[model samples]
Target chain A: MMKNSLMRNVPENYNPYVSSDDYKSKKRVLIDKKATNSTVEYLESYSDLFDKLNITDGMTLSFHHHLRNGDFVFNAVCQEIKNRGLKNMKLAPSSIFPNNQCLVELIESGAVTDIYTDYANGPVAECISKGKLKGEFLMHTHGGRPMVIESGAIKIDVAILGVPTVDKKGNGTGKIGKSACGSLGYAESDVTYAKKVVFVTDNLVDTLDDYQLDGKYCDYVLKVDAIGDPNGIVSGTTKITKDPVGLKIARMTAKLLDEFGVIKDGVSMQTGAGGTSLAVAHYVKNIMQERGIKGSFASGGITGYFTDMLEEGLFEELYDVQCFDLKAVQSTLKNTTHHVMSGSRYANCFDDNVVDKLDFVILGATEIDTSFNVNVTTDSHGKIMGGSGGHSDTAHGANITVITTNLIKSHMPIIKESVTTVTTPGADVDVLVTERGIAINPLRTDLIEKVKDSKLPIVTIEKLLETAHEITGVPQKIERSKEAVGYVVYRDGTVIDTIYKID
Target chain B: MKRGTAGTLESNDAMIMVKESDGLKITITSIVYDFFHEQIENVIRETLKEEGLTNVEVICNDKGALDYTIKARLLTAISRMEEEK
Candidate 1:
């Protein structure tokens, strides 16, 4: 069995993270952008669309994840492909949530030989960890996804998008219809890069006052009976955490931000769609309100909580790439200040992006090493569970990136000597906030000096690790494999870590 | 005691079910079983030995519970078994 408890660094094949200043540019995928064609086929069948696209074996088919876990189009399209006995097809969805469990079967049947995505969870993730996948799994960050595709490293044969509403000319809006998801940010890159773009919608209107998807980019439109449920956006946990441990960490992180003077007026921040992160946002919002701080904007997959801040005039605008809740979708419908942006505009570090403008950002972790390298990609057992959606992007861009999590999660220490996989390099990371104690990175001397004489429980990361070890005891080494199932690609288009298969 | 149960299936806790058995038998299922299974088994065996109880069956649904928690829960179940007798 492959032992996994040893102190391992970046593998030989991969480039170790040196400094964010040492970053290099990636390949730029070329798109032949043109005006709207005279003829746009509006069809009602997936089979016809596939046939029209002339899909063959090993073709790279892509999809947008705006529908999230409630999405019906991704599974439906993949199922049709499987039913046609297609093999070696490349599945490149922006991200895979739990509801897309059809992928588990697709992998098992050898129908999907390769996979590329920003994030993945549930059965598909578990399946990949077991090494059952027949080919390479390319894990990209939210921002890096735009980079990877635009650079031509990962090409799209066809882009199948599940939009909520589409007008007669193929103009689409994600903010209206029965299953409005609020933004088409992720699908924009696909529509531009893919050889053919298919817009699948259950609702078709004669005209849309504001459409996110331009008809010129779309080659075909599929009108389905139902696209997906809007409610699935909140299928996973994204509520403000009520757990005392979570609340404590959030409060401490907010206090740290205040002490560091990051909570001043015109501050720009981002947080993960997790309860702990949202709790941190909640605390930050309170701080903004108390100080009458009118921040510039909040960005990413926005939730109702963020909209509430915008509605109350706390922030000037909301940069929504995707909506996380129904309230957020409603906010987009009514609030003009709540704007829609493409994925590249949201976080493509090569050009002007939202994440780069962040003053401070709050993130969560499955494991964080003493060096501050994080692993939101795998569990302690070296199993695939999640990938970096925007973890590294925000961390790399934000001046202060705070990681908030419980010290002990389900009897496992959140702090480790070395993480199983490095999703975000330690060089970009700023601090770690746990319920037990807060650890400031040695590299961040400026932050350390800000709270040197504070009442907060500031301890070395090693001390926090010792406290956790004392409680959970030393766990046995987990089994792993020499054969890597996938690679965690950094925002800079460099391979940072390899996820070994479970032996 | 004829039968007893203690603790909960919550994280960092163990839900232990105990019933009358001719000899000591412990069956465990845990989320962290890969890493701490042997240590968990040893703790349960030692806890039983210290209690001077031989006739018992412990089924521990462990969600990464510590050694002391296992001992305390087992002890409570043992006390409940005696209360029934």
Candidate 2:
């Protein structure tokens, strides 16, 4: 069995054997010195690169998911491995998206047996959900990912970073290419900690005066025809939900932000890209405009709306860790105030990150219990779908963590007696705004007292639960087998919950 | 006899279609139907009653619309149906 020293005692029903603690960092005797000329080394093809590296079985490979559904590096590297007849390699990616379903074939063929990730979705996630893989999966949070990698708990053999634009000397940036993806935050840890790092890019410019990633972190530079699909690299648009109910919830959330003085001048915020969160941005923009309030910096997964705010002078700057759409990508290219940040600087709890400076954050959830505990990792059924990619991290860091979601969704009441899996502890969550009303966590007595006389409906979480139950009769508890699929590690490196295999 | 419709198939909104019917009957389909079915039905009923029309059929597809939006859409649909007549 794989042994792990960093693995905390997971809350019942999970296999504690994560991975062996015998992680040996790949030793580097010397750093590459700058040459008089551009002495950057390049590889002709993936075959040549793999042949030179002599990749063996059971070696761990790492990747970042900044490109989302557009990335080609993962597939290209995996296809090379398959062609080379390699097997049992541990696939460690920051996250897996719908386009990474090619990993299903890699797992089925035994090219990849083990997986480590902060998040996983699509076919590969489904494969792991069904226990189709030969080995266990280690699900870490965004902050936990860099923590483990940096602490030498999970040594990476090779990390392949895909960039949008690159120079001949391996200097690269995701901001100025056809497939620009805003920030390379998720790739930061892998580049810094991996034994070997490769820079793969499609837009090889003649010369780059400055780049986000310097050539110092790279060992090899490979040029591909297309690093990723630009269409998928950036969404065409990030529109707020037009649903009046969603609008109402969003309006109430904005009102609370303003009432609580979270929307004043020099405010800092982080909001997810879910419909309601986007709507919150829209309404918050209106409030900012109406009040003549300008914010200090807006951070996290940025969308066009946030970029528009930056341009409109609502916010002075944007510390983008990930761009959610094309407009955000465009803003990063030309706007110096729109800065790209590494994952460690973005939300890693071990470091002083941007999340620590956040005054307010708007998030979404699949389920929230009466205690305000949130579940975003699994569905109503006990299946593996998502992992915490800065969910709990921002929740822990933000001054006021607000969860905005419909009270009921897909015929299931979102307000449950207890969540299926506690991804974010209730103590970190401060408020919940639903279409029906708003419920403040009792722990935040200060906020409750402040908003007590607000025109918005202020109700107890128990009352919300009662209303939900009255609507959708108490739902049956999801069934699960004795087998554990994954463990949900909190932002601070503790195993808060264990995901059981769906029965 | 007149027929009118309001709203769209948006993420968090609902659409209501009011048609001249022989009897008072309301059909509500929603993403959150299990929880908000009754509340949505009440909004439609009260809306139609205020319009002084109990002989019309109401077809509503809800996308988690709040009570106010539901009432507003119902009233708008009724007003359009009246304009058609």
Among these predictions, the greatest lDDT belongs to 1
Q: How does model 2 score by TM-score?
A: 0.81
Q: Residue-wise lDDT of candidate 1 within A1-503, one digit each (tens)?
A: 22211233445655554555455443445445433565578875988888888888999999988888889999998888888999999989999989998889889999999999998899899899888899878899988888878777788988899989998888889998888888889998888777778999999989887999888788888999888975685443248888988999999999989999989889988887788889898999999888799999999889888998899998999998988887888889899999999898988877578888899888889999999999999988788888889899889889998888889877788889889888988878899999989999999999999999899999999999999999888778877677788888777676777788885
- Model 1 clash pairs are A27-A151, A28-A151, A29-A150, A29-A151, B1-B81, B1-B82
Residue A261 accuracy (lDDT) in model 1: 90
**Pairs that collide, model 2:** A243-B12
What is the number of residue pairs that collide in model 1? 6
Error of 1 at A193 (Å): 0.9
Each prediction's DockQ?
Answer: 0.72, 0.09
Error of 1 at A175 (Å): 0.6
Query: Where in model 1 is the C-alpha error above 4 Å?
Result: A1-21, A24-38, A234-238, B1-3, B19-23
Off by over 4 Å in 2: A1-39, B1-85
